[model samples]
Target: MTASAVKQGQTTTGHALPILSLAVGTFGIGTGEFAMMGLLPDVARSMDASIPQCGNIVSAYAMGVVVGAPIISLASARMSRKQALILLTLWFAVTNILGTLAHSVGALEFWRFLAGLPHGTLFGGSALTAASLVAEGRRGKAVGHVFAGLTFANVVGAPLASLMGEYLSWRVAYLLVGAIALIAAFMIWRFIPRDDPRPGHSLLGELRAFGRKQIWYVLGVVMLGTGGMFCVYTYVSAALLHVTHVPLWSIPLFQGLWGVGMVVGAYVGASAIDRNPLGATIGAFIWNVVTLSLFAFALPHLWSVTIIIFLLGGTIALGPAMQMRLMAVAGDAQTMAASMNHAAFNLANALGAWVGAFVLASGFGYAATGWAGGGIAIMGLLLFLLSVRGEPRLERSTDSSVRFH
Candidate 1:
């Protein structure tokens, strides 16, 4: 099977099995990535580390993502997407299990970093595969379907893992993630169709995609704007406990509500991107400014903060829009661009957590993360404007080489 054949198979047969299989992989990845936030307190106790120190564990995982995406994407350039995805899933499952076996903070961080190595490559390969399976105009919705798994992980997987961590152990949470990943690997092997090797695919070609200015600008938007959300999200448990006075048992419920918001945002953003990708991207950043700005004021009231967190979760809408924009500008190097999207996001994760931690360590309140996040969102909007100013005429051309759909 070839890439075109995969697209035709989906269109003619109306079969979504391949995309559904990919979603299973993303669900596992999402759970492994975000469940650590909820497990921070438990891990801190286990490692005899401070909350800020635990934050470095999160940063460690993100650093792995930033480093692994391009290298994995380029290394696997000659392989079929199916082979790459399966190998990546296997790597993911093994590393997550290793994470469960860690005995100290340094060991745990190392395991977490190893676990993150396949995160971006899997998502990128899955996104490109998903996009290839649909009509050009429906690419955003297809990618959104894959991401829905991630959002659903937040809803079901993250909350359950958090609850298990609360009642059982943080190690148990990692074990659960590993189990899900194992299932995903099986699903992909069983359901995803094989494709022929991509012709002329090379590491050098993938690297050259970065020569485009718009790619850098789009990545900047991801690193800066998306970091704002991570700034708030990374320490959400701490804030809920210390600031909102929420009970320990209720943490999962609050996280679940945030997931619900993401689920809604995914579909809405996909539709918006299909219509106007740039508009959707800008709008999400603007919305982030509003929601994150209110986070500080809302912190004093439980009901108000709950609402704000939900809205903040909805900022995930920016993801698909930015992804579609990257696809539009990547020319033939779709896989590289797609992988770098998550790399940029985890970079945002690292940047946001570092900044948020800085403020908290300096005698600023937890709510200060909200102010920091809002400021970053403003910078993201400015970058978006700059990207728009430099938008090449070819980007707007109807040429098949540049057109996304």
Candidate 2:
């Protein structure tokens, strides 16, 4: 379970340490990223803006990811994965530090945008790095383990960080995140293997990744499928506040439980994907459709809502499944395609938030997020089915390697 053991890929030693390190880094990032939502009232009050206006910060950050992932991934393709990760984490620390010191809403938004520039690229590169270090059949689990760091952040880091912000000051949370990023940078530099940069890995080669059709299909699946989850989750706090009648003090506890559900879902999903990736994805999507609908109905009862939230977390299994599926389909352009997966998911994040907000603004009530989410899940399912059915059959002499854009 130690970092050293994880570095050695010793399955028996628990892989816990490296996962913990990854999780710690993710914890800081998640805390800094998500705590803003909970602290919106405080941020708006301090900056003298409306709640919706402060939401512009979130949009700005997402735009950063939409712009940053491909640029960073291609620009850094020539570097070793480990070195790239370290460099990315270093930038993470700097941007977050600036975020903590911003004097105005405009300044804060700018810094938050900068802070997000490394977000998707970091996860994409880290997932690839984690996969490269593991044996076959365990690759999915390893990637899941690394991502568990982020998921755990939901359960533990975000709630605690938000509570600290609520009790103390939001600025303190950003400080903690900056410090953790620094630690992750140091750990990545020290423990990660040193390898020569790839030969002729140019930005042009990376851009060529778009030449394939399957890539677009994968992206479609990711954006639509995962968007459903975000539609509900992006508004969970609001739901609890308005419908469940949970006290502000109890909000973090519920959110933390959702995180725990994510952790369990992630590990179990990893195992399932390793066994049968395609089947697992389909099943997970279907499961999301059903559970998310049930979640909407249970929202009025606190105890039932909590359990439903945990069940809803199971939808995260889609993440690893889609990620692995993209790897299979991406061929030589694995790097950019992998990085783009996170980009696609974040796009889902933006879509889900916008749509859910629109529904709420239209007077449908807070519980509309679940219906919004379920609608998204069903759309994703249809797309997946079409993708599979539309796949062209090959002649005996022709080759078939799943190609991804």
Candidate 3:
């Protein structure tokens, strides 16, 4: 397979161009996913629907992610990574544009759900492809490079798309998102050489990931531990208004600062994971505990609150290491395992928001969300400890079989 040549770093195209094409694909996905949130009010107004009603469209997309990941992974199990990436991007581009043109909320929701169907699968292909291009222990850095596009979208792509929606039309904004996806598809086709699937690829091999307990533990850690991000983030606007008392106009700036922190965290996390995946995961959780706990106390002061939010965002550093660990244990089922990572991310978002809302409804103040999120992080950490208890300090990925420790 030509992929093996690329994997060995012997291809004339090298790794940068192919990896970059994948990153652009992720950038488009992230921009469309997040920029839609900012465009919701306009969409609601155009459709004569309530903002609450429009929220279902967002939920519909997330639901698609959860439903689509596993199915797509199974279906595409034997396709070359490059082909999978291109097809997924094209699907995203078309469905997103179709959803943007829908005149009714239900129609839009249906199309948006279709648009989301490719999301997790695309990320899975991109991560695996990127990691495959590097040496064994360096996968973290390669995966991080792909994810950097998603983080950067938070900083630039979403903001620009949101601005277009605010100043022009929401339809125009989403069409631009489709354009980015289309461009990503074109770049992938032009850059990624024709290649074949790995030897002995089979759906049964992919299914084997589920039989391993470690995969479940990694997913649980992500769903619970990483969830603290959304727990605080979901309510951050409210917190800024009620506790931090920031002016409404400055809220986006604070959010942008958080995105900046994520960009930095990705790089640092990549290096940490390359050195020690286990240690990086533990350190990230510990960092989350401290920042989340401090968030409650810091709310009264603007600078302190600002710093806390950034640090909380920086906890994204946990993602790459955790994902690498999953890949390590997944054995031959790495495709399914990697695909589930983004699905768990969406689940975490829902879980965290629910927990944050629960605390608020139970008479806990906005500040209490920090503590609630902190408590969840602690639970995740404890679960991880139990998961790895009595196991070796390092997991060996020398072969394509389940690695217990």
Best candidate according to TM-score: 1
Backbone clash numbers for all candidates listed:
0, 5, 0
- TM per candidate comes to 0.95, 0.91, 0.90
Q: What is the lDDT for 225 in model 1? A: 81
Estimate, for each residue in 245-361, the C-alpha lDDT of model 2 and write its tens digit: 888888888878888988888888888888766677788899889878887799999878989999888888888877777777667776788888888887888888898899899
Cα lDDT computed for each candidate against the true fold: 0.85, 0.78, 0.80
Clashes in model 3: which pairs?
A: none
Clashing pairs in 1: none
After superposition, the stretches of candidate 1 with alpha carbons farther than 4 Å from their true spots are 1-3, 6-9, 390-399, 402-405
Best by lDDT: 1
Would you list the rank order by TM-score, best first? 1, 2, 3
How displaced is residue 97 in candidate 2, in Å?
1.5
Residues 330-388 of candidate 3: C-alpha lDDT, one tens digit per residue: 87787889888888877777787778878988998999989988988998899888878
Model 2, residue 152: distance off in Å is: 0.4
- Higher-ranked by lDDT: 1 or 2: 1
